[model samples]
Every structure is written in structure tokens, then in C-alpha cells.
Target chain A: MRRFSWFNATSLTLGFAFLYMPMVILIIYSFNESKLVTVWAGFSTKWYGELLQNEAFLSAAWVTAKVAVASSTIATVLGTMAAYVLVRAGRFRGRTLFSGMIYAPLVMPEVITGLSLLLLFIGIGLDRGVMTIILAHTTFSMCYVSVVVSSRLVSFDRSLEEAALDLGCSPFEAFRLVTLPIIAPAVISGWLLAFTLSLDDLVIASFTSGPSATTLPIKIFSAVRLGVSPEINALSTIMIGIVTVGVITASLISKRASLRLQAEEQAAART
Target chain B: MRRLLLISVPYLWLLALFLVPFFIVLKISLSDTALAIPPYTPTLDLGAGWAGLKGFFAELDLENFWFLTTDDLYWKAYLSSVWIALFSTLLTLIVGYPIAYGMAQAREEWRPTLMMLVILPFWTSFLIRVYSWMGILSQEGVLNQFLMWSGVISDPLMILNTNTAVYIGIVYTYLPFMILPIYAALEKLDISLIEAAEDLGCSRFQAFWLVTVPLSKNGIIAGCFLVFIPALGEFVIPSLLGGSQTLMIGKVLWEEFFNNRDWPVASAVAVILLLILIIPIILFQRNEQKQREAEG
Candidate 1:
């Protein structure tokens, strides 16, 4: 089974390098004291220091975090509900339409989605601002959350809930006490996915955002469009660092949880 | 009652926000551009009920959609977007297939780490990834500097602000979308199937071609749709990496709506794009439904 063939090794190495090399270069050059993005000078932390003092970038980061938190929270609630219904509610009226709406956002072009949302806001006389952006973000991101949670729900053991019901637990009680806890990890991951989607969105935010609601991606886009600078490199490196740490921590947590679950199962089997 | 409450909340939200907006776009597309807030007219006044509806219907015209057809720029943008999306999807398949296959073939102990490696970059900021390429592909960028320093070329190659850059940016950003699905499909695949194929009269290449490729067809189609659909409407990559002559409909729509302030035309562009995308969208939905059924 251990096929360490030349072809497999080469393809994997090349693919990973192609995937990772740009970020590595960006991170390395972030420390370069040279003003030019490509040039290498003596290493310094001046760009990072400058980045800290930049009011606009900091404000944009704050706005982005606020939107991400709000949108992901709402999307999680709605998406979790949607997922449960899709998986457990059995066939109902408008099931096709419900499922269609759920999946449509996943593949819909950002331009059309953004444009349509913006127009909806305008037609309804809602001012384009943070609220509108949150609404727009929630609309799209909930689909990702639903897909994540629903997949988990699909293979879920329903007999557990049935046993709970047979033992005098109400359906709601059974779900709240038993089912929700089991699916909590998937729900959490769905929230995280939604949060990241909101944070990373530029085009939709660009369309729905007014003057006061500039997101981090929007700010970064405008700045990068002007020209690449050492400050942007510094900022990007910090972002990459944060994301790497977060992902590693998440994977570690899940790994530990799974390990504990395995230990419990083994103990039960032994008993 | 509880089930109904659960069902209606998300359904109503999507209806109001996601489903209803398209009608607004359609209505706006039919209306003439106006120098007023909300931009297009004649406005549908629900308060006026039937008379207003009749007035709005009367004002509605196909002029904007007609304009889209007549304009060479719009058609070029549409055609080129489809063309670029098609080729980039192919490029991603070529590059992604080996990585996905390798991951699927890797030892179980290392699979999680490999999966994490793939998913980690996907969760990072997409705009920053594209921006990173500006550094790599710009004339004075890293690649050029490295090539020049290594004496590979006396002159820096012009890779940035071209169709080539657009392709690279798209293929790079959308690579994860292509790989993850195929990886999932390949991971679910039984190695014994391949072994059995080999035990028969098939060579390794033949085994892969006959057994693995056909098996992964669902994932490949899903991946292609994932890459091709969004790439068709991609705004950021073409705007950032593509040159002035680059004719992506997303960029065109952005310019139309944001710069030119022509809501009717932009809405018309969107409507047409939706019409074009309807087939793929249905296909994607069908694929998903099939996968769900298979899983069940």
C-alpha cells in the first residue's frame, strides 16, 4: 500500500508548492524593509508598526468583525433550522422550492446576487449600510451553513431520538438535550464557515455597502488596486498567521474530541 | 406547528431576500433608466394596485435587453467569460486531479493532515490570494526578479494584466473547489475495485482510466460546475489580473452598474446571465439531488 512512486511524490510536491508558494513569498517579503513589494532589503517591523497606527484599516477590520459575527450568528440560527427541517421534516409543501433556495446561493454568481440584493434594498427604501450588508451576507452564507449541517444530519442515527421519545421525552426536549449536542460540532463549523464567507466577501459587500460600512476585503481591494505596498504585505502576513493558528487549533480540538469519543466507545464495549 | 414554524422562518427569509429580488431585477430591467432614487422607472407602486401595475407593465420594455444584443462589447464580454470559464475549469481539472488522487491514495494516518492543508488555504481571504499573485506576476514581481536573477531571461515576461494572469488567478483560487469534491469521491472509492481491475487483464493506467476515472465522474462534473459557474461571473480576478481588453461579463456588469449608473442595462445583463446559467444551475442541482439520494 505504501507506493512512494516518483510520479506521485513529484505531483504532490509540485501541487503543494504551486498552492503555497505565493503566500510564502508574500509572508517572507512582508518583513522586507524595502518599500517595493518585490525587492528584498534588510528586515524590519516598520510596516507592521505603520499598519497598527492606520485608522482606516483598523476601522475596516472592526467593521468586518462586527459584520462577520452578526451575519454568521443569524445565518447559523436560520441555517440550523433550515438543515433540521430539510433532513427531518419529511416532504412538505414547497419542499422543492425550499431546497432550491437553499442550494441556489451556493452556485449563484456574486454579481447577480449582489446586484439583486442591492436593488431589493433600494426598492424597499432601505439605506445601504451595515444592516443591508448583514442581510445580504446572511442570505448567501446560510446556504453554506445549511449544507454543512444537513450533511451531518443525513447520516445521523434517528433511533436515539425515537428512544428518547419512547421514554417520555418530548420531541423538542429530545432534540434540545440529545440531537443538538451531537450535531453541535457541525453547527459550530457551519458558523465558522459562514463567518469566513462573510469576511472574505468583497463583491457583494462592495455592492450592498454604503460609505460607512467598508469591509476589510473592500478596503484591501481598494488599497491593492492602487498598488502593492509593504504595509499590505505586513497586513496579509498577519492575516495568514491568524488563519493558520485558528485552523490548527480547530483541527486539534476536533481531534481531541474524536479521540475522547473513541475512548468512551472502547470503554463501553469493554464493559 | 413547531415544524411549520421551523420551516417557514428560513423559507420566508429566502423568499423575501433571495427569491423576490430577481423579480425586482426583471422589473427594473424592463423599465427605463431615470434620474431619481431607485434609478429605474416606471416604479411599481403596490399602493396603486391594478392601475399602477398596468402603468408599470406599459412602461416596461425590452429596450435594455435589446441593447445588450446589439452592443458588440456586451456580446464579447459574455462570450469571453464563458470561454475563459470553460478553459480555466479544464486547467483546474488537469492540475487538481493528481493532487486529489494522491491524497486519496495516501496513508490513512496522513489523510487528515493533507485534508487540513487543502482546506486551510480555502478558508483564507480570497482577495489576498489574488493580491499575492500581483506580487508574483507583476513585471518587477517576484517571478520576474527570480527569473532575471537566475539568467533565465534577460527581459521580464509580461504575465500580469493579461488573459494568462486571469487564468492563473482563477485556476489558483478555484483549485480547492475542484480538488475537494474529487478527493471526496476518490476517498469513498474502494481500492479493491482498482485491485480487481489489475487482477484482470488491465494495466495500471488502464485500471485508473477504466475504473477510477469513471467512478470519479460525478465528482469531476460537480467540481467543473463549481469552478465554471462562479468563474463565469467572477469579478475580482478579471478586474485585478486581467488587462483592459479583458472582457468578462462580471467586470462589465460592475462597470455598468457602479460606474455608468445604468441600472436597467446592468439588470438586463444580470437577467441574461441568469438565463445562460439556468442550464448549469439545473444540472448542478440535479447532481446534488442524485448525490443526496445516493447517500441516503
Candidate 2:
């Protein structure tokens, strides 16, 4: 008769604690005045201030942003196309091959992807930098985008597109007027996912990045490798802060949108 | 023309950037090592026509693959990577399944927030999460300090730079991958089915074992592969948290490339790793295909 069992409650609590405890500790200790990470010598915002002044970290952040923006945009476009082709392009030659490439990157190890792309650049005598990094990120992240968009495409109403085409809309116009609008949300989500994947990447960036194209993750990894610094903790806390705000805002917006849609549906039913 | 253009956009992008690069890695895996810029001989310089192709073919050999066979360390690193990855996948599933099931059964309003928490860490920098563990598990880290302060132990534990830390890091990082898929499967389960089973004299535990476990098998498999594949090639976690003693294939590939500057052997390691992963990759794709067919 118990709905929320004690077992489930315990597991959820323990799992969440396990997940968040380390991050919480890291964030709290980032505020410590002491240079030593373990011993607290009163709280201060000095680490955050120091982080802002660190030119290397700032440049890395800038480079990361640039690569993320570029790669995600490119990935979204190509991925949407790929998803549409897979869903609509009937009996296309080499369909198996196309789908294989799409799914391969989703499960491909970052190390292998990184190494392969690095070798490709070297084989062709191309320079390694932000551009090459963008290429590498786009190659991997497009698989994610395709997966997201294709799921949406699968459940989409075919009649809507048929009606648009029957009403004298060209095929492209039918797609633009009907299909694209409906799938826009999925595509947007795909783009955001790709953006984060690019932003969060370390191995691929490290492999492909040349001089003057260090990413935030690469820089952070090097710093952490050398030793744990309070500044790194401060930076991580800020990153967590940004992610929390973004996720909250996204969920709220989606919740409101779904509620509005339900209300509209109810009104339509009443009429 | 439009269809062609639409298809070719992604197809060509992937062909150029993804597929071609893999072939290049395959090619590089065969070539000999060098000390010059680019650091490998017998470049596949196709622009130079047939003569260049002939030269490239002439320089290619199985030397790097042979080198891998001769080195015991490479074999150990690879076997250890697979061993660690498999165990961690099981661990992630054990820790993640209950949380995912709880989230599925939670109030509809609460489910989204719970899912968001699972995904939020994924959005944060992966390296930072690994770095957070370094702080917790180090000899003089917060964990040891707390235990010492509480009089739990007189001496600090050597948790960092060990295989245990690697497992902890992998499980922590990849837990969401296990959770999300299982939650997706569990969320779609019909409450009526469980009720039906209960009415048939099946206890709740039996109902769960017979009904839930059987139903969620696909998700479990998918989630395991999701955790296992990347965990196999996880360079960052092993390198950052694990010591030199932890011999993961990723770390070995990295050392061979950067420290030894042996691109051919590194590529060979990667090629072998990919060959090993191909089985799981194929199985994952087939599972996805079966799901799609079922949905249709």
C-alpha cells in the first residue's frame, strides 16, 4: 500500500548526495582565504578576482566560446539535414553508410576521434588551431544533433506537410511552412546540446589545438594536473552557476510553454 | 536537386571530416615513425598523382602493429581498460538504476527537476568534475582531513592515483548516461501492468523482477554500452585521477603519442581499440534499429 517506498526514497537521497556532495564541497572551499585548499582561513572572494585577472584562462574561455559557437552552428545545420534525409529520403543509395557514419560518432571514443582527426589534419598538411578544433567538434557533435532531431521527426504528423503541399506550396515551401516550424524546438535543443558538448570537450580539443588556441577545459586540465588551485575551484563554481541558471531558465520556459499549449487545447475542445 | 543537396550537406561533411579521418588514422597506423614536422613518413599525398601513391604504398608496413604485439605493457593497458570499463559500467548501473526508477515514479512535476539535476553535471566541464574528485580523494584532501578530524583514522588513506579513484571518477561522470536511458524506459511502463500482476497473486518484488526487469532490458543494455564505450577510451579520467600504475589504453595511447612521439604506434593502439569497440557499437546500433522498428 505504500506508494513511495522507503527503498526508493533512500536510493534517491543517497544517489543525489553522492552526485552533489563533491561539487558542493568544491564550491564552498573555493571561497576559502587560505592558499592551501584543505585548511580554511576565513572566507574571501580573492580567488574569483584572481581568476578574472588570469589572462591565460580568459583567452582560453574566449577561444572555447568561439569554437563552441562555430561548431554547434555548423553541426546543427548538417545534422538537421542528415536527420531529414534519413527520415524522408526514401531508398537513397548508400543509406546504410550514411546512417553508419551518423551513429558511429555517437559511440566513438573521444580519444580515437581526436587521434583520427589529428592525423587527418597532419596527413593533409593542414594547420591545427581553432579551425581544426571546430572541425573535430562538429564531426562528433553532429551525431548528437541528428539523434535529437530525428526523434522529433519520427513522431511528426505527415498530414500537415501533405496539406501544405496540396495548398500550392512548393516542396521546399511546404517544409519551410509546416515541417520546419514543428521541428524547430528539437533542432534548437540539438544545437544547444552540440554547443555544450563542444564547450565541455577536453580530449579532442587537446589533440587538435595548436598554439594560440587553448580551450577552457585544456587550460583547466593543465592547471589541475600541475596542482589544485583555489582559482580553478572558483572558475568551476562560476561554470556551475552559469549552467544552473541556464538549465533552470530552460525548464521554466518549457514548462510554461507546455502549460499554455494544454490550456489552448482545452479551449479548442470547449469551442 | 534539393533532395540531393540536403542529403549531400551532412553526407559530405561527415565523409570529409569523420570518415576520411578514420581512413587517415588507418593509413597512419601502417606508416613508420619519423622526426620531422608531422612526424610520420609515407604521407598519402594524393595531389602528387600515381607516383606519390606508389611511394606511399611502398612505405606502409605492419611494423607498428608488430610493435604493439611485442610490448607487454600495451597489451596489459588494453586489457585493463576493458576490465575497468566493464566493472564501472556495472557499478554505474547499480547506483543509477534506483535513482532513475525513483525519478520515473516521482510526481510528474518533480520528474523534470530530477532529470535536470542529472543533466546539469553533464553540461558542466567534465575535467572540472574529475578535478573535484582529485580534491576529495587526495592524501591530504578534504575526505582524509574530515576523517582525521572525526578521529576515524590516524593516517590519511591513499585514494588518489589509484584504480579505485578511476572507478569512482568514471562512475560519477558516467552515471547520468546510465540513468537517463533507464528512466526513459521505466517512465513509459504501464502502472496497470503491475496492478495486473498483483491481482494474479504475484508479490510486488516478483512483479518487478518478472515484469520490470524483462521490460527494461533494452534500456539497460543501451545504458551499459553508453557508459562502457567512452569509458574504454577515457583518457582524461585515467590521466588525471589515476597514477602511472593505472594502465588504461587511453593513457598508454597518450604517452606513446606525446611522450614518445610515436604516432604510428599510437594510431595502432587506437585502431586496435576501435576494433575491440566495434562489437559493442554494432550491437548498440542494432538495438537502436530494433527500438525504431518496434516504435514504427
Candidate 3:
């Protein structure tokens, strides 16, 4: 057996505390009742009520929700199509370039991305608004979606596709009818991924977005410069709750599907 | 064969939107800083330029490109960004490795739960999380309140609006980015290899060093890049946390382009920033290619 020492215990405690202490503090203070952030008065949810009634923040959040939905929806289809092309298009000229192009944003600095898009819109004389923000968000988010979709695309059984074509169905029909169902989940997850990315983004949104096109993040950022209150913590706790529930649900669904895949494989072997 | 064109359409869309935008940035960066509406004067003439193109490319200049190095503030910001990014990445590794190891060692069923825990932050808005740190670390905030409540000090500690806050903010936001890839790497590690090391009379530490650490190096590298690259250009964290004291390249770039409206200088800074990052990016791609080849 490995040796257990006091030093090890201390270090582990420090490590765990370092990882979780801030989050603990944030959650605890979310319930602070007083407007005075320094003092511990009591507990309340008034800040949440305040958040609900704040029309400016609510509308900005609504705009953010709309952008996430529209951009992610567009990105899912485009990204899946891009992945299909990348995976199914075969080795050809510009394939390397095409792949590199998709990944450029992954490593490219956000300042560059934001600047380039800003300059592009200005040069084209296009008005800066939600439309521009949506376009920019989709550009980077689509790369992420494509990468995810194509990984699953690589693991797919090609013979199933080939067999469908042999059974008197056109290539498009075969893909639409056969391949779509198997890969549709990846596409949906890609959309979720895109939605999260769009929601999280601030720099790209800041650059392309006009004064009227404020995202929740941008709004929070501007408000935060004045100093943070418990209201921000309350907002975070709610966000954490939503995201935690979403991720747990996804993990459960994924676990079920993987188990089902294994069981089907085993049953096939028995046959 | 006819199906190939259908496949190509998606890429064409990216080329038109994504690629074209950068191409335009490249174009504007090459042009002279004029007082035109777009504030660009197209030369299309290099005048025996760096690339030595005559008619089609004579409008570009190496003046703005070479002129960037002369600015002391720009270099200072660059150095500051590099320092912050490196330190934050190092801090993340120190904190993340143990959790990754624990998660990797857990039962298969438990591993997914741990992974979901790490990824739960990503599902929420990062902007909110960073802002959450701002609240926690501010002078009159919970951190100070708690410290004072415990009678640990006579007065509140002035922690906010400093370089320390910038580091805290960055690590808070990026810790999961560092953790996930490492956890993914550690999970796929072969248990038998570690067992073999143990059977050969190696201690747990030795087993980790000899068997586990080397195996997960790719994940470590990927995790470092994932944090470092973004942190290098991070704006929101430094801007909010550092206030006026923190000067990073990203903030400088923002001030130059947006605040001062100096488009040419901003693009010049961007060009240099891209040039600096290309080597590391290429190395990252090469490693990714090697990993893919091994897996394939």
C-alpha cells in the first residue's frame, strides 16, 4: 500500500479548496439579503426579483437568446454539411487547405477575428447589428460544430450508405433517409455547442454589435465595471443551475445510447 | 462524381463569409492610412515592396508593418500578455492534474459524471463566470467580508483593480479548459501499463512519472494551448479585473482600433500578433496530425 502522510493530506486539502473555494463563496453570497455587499445581514431572493423586473437586462437577454437560437440553428445545418463534405469528399486538391480553413478560428486570436469582421463590415458599408453578430458567431461556432460532426462522421459505417445506394435510392435520398437518422444526434449536440459558444462570446459580439445590439454578456460586463453586487452572483447561480441540469441530461442520454450500442453489438454477435 | 459539387457548397459558403473577411482585413492592412471614409488609401503598388509585386500589389507598404516595433507600449503589452498567459496556464496545470488523475482512476460510470462536472461550466456563459469572480474579489465583496468577519484583519484587503485580480479572473475562467482535455487524455490511458510498472516494484509516483505522465503529454500540451492561446488575447478578464493598471496586448489592440479609431496601426499590430503566433500554431497542428495518424 502507498504511504499516507500529513503533508499529502494538507496538499490535497489545499488543492481541492483552490479549485472549489471561489465557487462556494459565490454561491453563498448569492443569498445575501443586504444591498451593502460587505456586511452579512440575512438571506433573500430580492435580487432575482429585481433581475426579473429589469426590462433593459431582460430585453438584452432576450436578444441574446434569439441570437443563440438563430445562429446555432444556421450553424448546425451548415456545419453538418461542411463535415459531410470533409468526411465524404475524399482526398482531393485543396482538402488540406479546406480543413485548415475550418480550424483557423480555433487558434486565431479573438482580437484578430473581431477586428477583421469589423473592418469587413465597415468596408462593405453594412450596418452593424444583431445580423452581423449572428454571422460572426456562426463563422467560428460552425468550425466547432463541423469538427464534432466529422469525428462522429468518421466512425460511421460506410457500407450502410453504399448498400442504400445499391437498393435503387439516389445518393441524396440514401443520405436523407439512412445516414441522417444515425448522425442527427451529433448535429443536434453541435447546435447546443454552438448555442453555448454564442452565448459565451463577448469580444466578437462587442466588435460587430452596434449600441442597440447588446448581448447579456456585454451588458453584464459594462455593469460589472462599476463593481459587482450579489445580484451578479444570483445571476450566476441561476446560470449554473440551468447549465448543470442541461449537461446532466446530456450525459444521461449519451450513457444510455452507448449502452444500447454495446448491447446491440453483443446481440448481433450472438446471432 | 457529380455529388462532389454538392459537398463543396458548404466550404464555398465559409470561403465567402469567413475567408473573405480576413482577406479584406489583409487588404486593408496593406493599404496606406488615409483620411478616406473607410480611412484607407489603396496603393496596389509595392514600389519594389517586400514581396516585389508591381501592378496588382503596389498599394501595400512595409512602413506600418516595420513601424510597430518602435512603439514601447505595444511591446510592453505583448510582454504582459505573454507573462499573464504563461503564469495562468502554469497555475491551471498545478490545480488540474490531481483532479484529472482522480477522475481517470474512478470507475467508468463515475468518470462521465466527473466529466460532466468539468464541462458544466462551459455550458454556462464564460462572461458570467468571469464576472462572478469580479464580485468575489472586489474590495467590499464577499472575499473581503469573509476575511474581515473572521477577524483576520483590521480592514478590507485591496485586492481588486490589480494584476493579481487579472490572474485570478483568468484562472477562474480557464481552469476547466485546462481540465477537460487532460481528463479526456487521462481517461483513455491504458491501466495495464501502470499495473505493469507497479508489478515491477515501482511506487505510485514512479508509475505516474514513467507510465502515466508521458502518455498524457498530448493532453497536457493541448490543454496548455487551449488556455494559453486564448489568454494571450484575452480582453474581458484583464479589462474588468485590471481596470487601468493592467495593460495587455488585447486591451491595447482594442484601444487602438476602437477607441482611437487608428485602423492602420491596429491592423499592423494584428499582423504582427498573427506572425508571432504562427510558429506555435504550426507546431500545434503538427502534433495534432501526428496524434490523428497514430489513432487512424
Candidate 4:
């Protein structure tokens, strides 16, 4: 182990504070009893109760849930197949183009993507609703799912699947017996990532959704313009809790994998 | 045949939905801004038998493209968005680099906690995070209140309804983007390079400036591009924080399409924005390809 110092420890503290202070305030304020925001009248769960009573928000949450589940499942299946082809085939024409097209929406200015999609929908005379939202969400999300599953498939030792094939199993049967179980984690991770993205999305969903199909972000957006109420803070706080847990879990898993790699490297050096 | 079938499905979906939408935008940009649904009818000869702008739609005139070029407001919005995005990206790099550096130094157990903290904001709704800053920086908000309480000022600061607010919002939202990529590069860096620099009669600060900064450039560039492009088209952070005083091209485009119901000009603006965005992307891809070939 390397020598530690006050300077290094202090910076870590400061970094964590910078990252989490706003969220801390949000969670704290969620329990504040004041109807008027920014005032800490007292601590209470009144607003969380109020959040429970919001039928519209509940219904909006339901819509967002439907979109997330539907879109993420579709994205996971499509993305996994694409990933398998790109990695297993070793080479293919137009794979890069396909990857680029799928991923473009991921980083493209949402304004451009959203506007273009909106224009397309309106031009085609398609009604803006759940279907449009699902389509737009799935397009970008498939990229993430594909990347996750594909990266895992890339480094995987192929001999295991080949052995299963040699033992009188067909390619499909061998894959079901071997690769499927191994790559299942990647599929789950991709599904989770897509689910969160679809849940948290506002910009694309806004353009594609009709009046009857507002998501949570749209609801919070419209209500926020009215004023800062504790209800908004409460919702934000709950969202922060879920995402914080997810990010921590992902980081731990990745770090553990790297550590395992390092241990193997050290063992090889000894030999 | 199985491989081909696997490939074609995603390809067709992208062609039908993703690529086609941009084509639709391109087609609309070519038409006159006459609020046409599917965009028919060219410019009218008002003097002869008043119809639409047949002159505008004519390939010879290129009237709509010319109009976007000459429009001062459109150009100003474009310029302002670019400048602001530049500043925000630069700011995020400055702040995020140090934090990433410090994280790279932490113990293995501690690094994940730190990374989780960085990505925590990502899990929440982006709009809500931007909205939360509204509470923090508003006139009666925490920032102004702290300033007043500490006698930093007698009155509340006019920080909310200005470009300053937009800057704050952009930096707040995008700092994560800059930090994550930089951290990835820095974390993967071999630490002995620093020792190598130190062994060569370099001080710690000098070692970092000499070795670390150059090593982190690719990540910095990727982070900056990620932040800058999105910052270019950001509507929510600017509008919510800057309020009505902010006239970003995004808002301008939104107004033309939704409020003004002028699809043609709106499409023109979208085309222009897409053109601007595509420049960086093509350049980045080409550079990455070059780097790959050099390594190969």
C-alpha cells in the first residue's frame, strides 16, 4: 500500500461533498413542513403523504413505468442480438454504421433528435402518445444495451462454447447451454440501464408524448413552473435515493472485476 | 442467413425511424415557411395571382436558406449558444479535472464510493436537478440568502434571471460528464509515470503538468465535446434558469415549430443546428479512425 496523506483525504471529502450536498439539502428539505419552500418550519412526512394522494402523479408514474418496462425489454432483446452478431462473427459489413446510428441519439443534442422525431411524427400524421414515446426511447436505449452486452461478449473465451458444440450439441443448443448463462449478467445490466434512462428521460419523451401520456419528468416540469413546493423536492429526493444505490452497485461490481484481473496478473507474473 | 437476419432487423428499424426523421427535417427545411402540414405550395407572385412563395421554394433562389443566413437574431442565438457552451465546458474541465485527479489517488475501496457520488446526480431526473438549482440560486433562495446573512450584500443578488444563471445551470448539469471521462483516463494511467517524472528531477506539481495533463488530453477532449454539444442545444436549463430574458436558438426553434406553427423555418433552424453538430462528430470519428490505424 502507498503512503496516505491529509491532502489526499481532504480532497476526497471535498469531492464527495460537492457531488452530494445539493442532494442532501433536497432530501432534508423534503421533510420540511412549510408549504412555502426554503423555509425549514419543522421536520415532517406530510409532503410524502401528499405525494401519495396525488392521483395524477401516480397515474403519470404508471405511464412512465409502462414505457420503461416495454421499451427496455424491447431494447434488451434487439440490442443483445446486435451485440452477439458484432462480436461473435468477428467481422461484418455495416456494423460500424449500425452502431453509430444506434448510438447517435445517445449523445446527439436532444433538441435536434426530439425536433426531428416530432416533425416526422407530425408529418406522418401519427398521434403523439405511448407508442411514439416507446419508439424514440428504444432507438437510443438499444445502443446502451448493445454496448453493454457486446463488450462482455468480446473478451469471453470462445473455447467453452466450442467444446459444448463438439459434444454433440448444435450451435443454438450450445449457446443456450454455455454463452447464455455467462452473458446473462450483461443483459440484466443493460436492461437496468435502459430502464433508468427511460424513466429519467424528459426531452425526447416530451416531444413524442401526447397530453394524455405525460411522464414524471413532464409532470414535475409543469408543476415546478408554478413554484417550489416541498412535493417537488420530495419526488426528487426519492429519485436520488434509487439512482444513488444503483450507481454504487455498478461501481462496486466494476471495481471488483478490475481487482480480480490484477490478482490474476500477479499470479501469472509469479509463474 | 441467420447472421444476415440478425443484422437486418436493427438496421431496418434505424432506417425507418432514426435516419428517416432527419431526412424529414431536411425536406421540411427546403420548403417555404407557410405553415403547411405536409409542406406543399411554392412562393406566390403576389402581384399576379397571390399564391405561396414559389420564389422561396425555387432551387434557384434558395430563399429559406438565405433567410436563415441573413437573420440577425438567429445568428446571434447561434453565436451566444456556442460561446456559453464553450465557457461551460471549459469550467467543467477546470473543476472536474482536480476532483478526478484526487479520486485517482484514493484507495481502491474509497474510489468506488467517490465514483458513485459523481454519478449520483445522473440517476435523478435532469429537469428536477435543474429545477433544484432554481431553489438554490433564486432571489429568495439559499445562495442569495447566505450572501445576505453574511453581510456579503444588503439586498438579494440579481443572479437568477441572467446569463450567469444559465452558466451555473450548464456547469452544474455537465460537470459529471467532464469528470467521468477524465476520471476514466486518469484512473487507467500507470502511476509509475509520475515516479518516473519525479526521478528525473521534477517536483510533484511540475511532474503532473508535464506528464498527467498531456496524458489526460483525449479524455478532456471527449468530455468537452460531450458537454459542449449538448450545451449547444440545451433548452430547459437556459429557459428555466434564465427565464424569458434567455433567447437561445433552441427556444427560437421551439417557438417557430410549436408556438408560431411555422414548420418550414423551424425545420431550417433544426437543419442548421444539425449541420453545426455534425461537424464535430465527423471530425471526432475521423481522428479516432486515424488513431486506430496508427496503433495498428
Tell me, by TM-score, which candidate is best: 1
TM-scores of the models, in the given order?
Answer: 0.96, 0.95, 0.90, 0.89
lDDT of 1 by residue, A182-256 (tens): 788899889989998998999999999999889999999998887688889999999999888987887788778
Model 3 alpha-carbon miss at residue A261, Å:
5.5
Q: Model 3 Cα RMSD, Å? A: 3.8
Model 4 ranges with Cα > 4 A deviation: A1-6, A90-93, A246-271, B35-61, B286-296
In model 1, pairs of residues that clash are: none
Tens-digit lDDT string for candidate 3 (A38-107): 5668988888998888888889889899899999998888888889878988787778878887888888
Q: What is the total number of backbone clashes in candidate 3?
A: 7
Please give the distance, in angstroms, between residue A22's alpha carbon in candidate 3 and its true position after superposition: 3.5
Pairs clashing within candidate 4: B42-B53, B42-B54, B43-B52, B43-B53, B43-B54, B44-B52, B44-B53, B44-B54
Clashing pairs in 3: B43-B59, B44-B57, B44-B58, B44-B59, B45-B58, B45-B59, B46-B58
Kindly report the docking quality category of candidate 4.
acceptable
The lDDT of model 1 is 0.92
- Candidate 2, B129: how far from true, in Å? 1.3
The lDDT values for all models are 0.92, 0.90, 0.80, 0.80
Error of 2 at B224 (Å): 1.2
Instruction: Name the docking class for model 2.
Output: medium
Per-residue CA lDDT of model 2 for B1-296, tens digit only, reads 98899989899988998899898889889998888877889766789999998988988999999999898998998899999999999999999999988888887878878888898888877888999998899998999999999999999999999999999999999999999999999988888888899899999899999988888888898899999999998999999899979999988888888789989899999999999999888888789889979987
The most accurate candidate by DockQ is 1
lDDT of model 4 at position A138: 87
Model 4 Cα lDDT, one tens digit per residue, B163-257: 89898888888888888888887887888888889999999889889998988777788788878878888888887888676768887887776
In model 1, what is chain B's TM-score? Answer: 0.94
What TM-score would chain B receive for each of the candidates shown? 0.94, 0.93, 0.88, 0.88
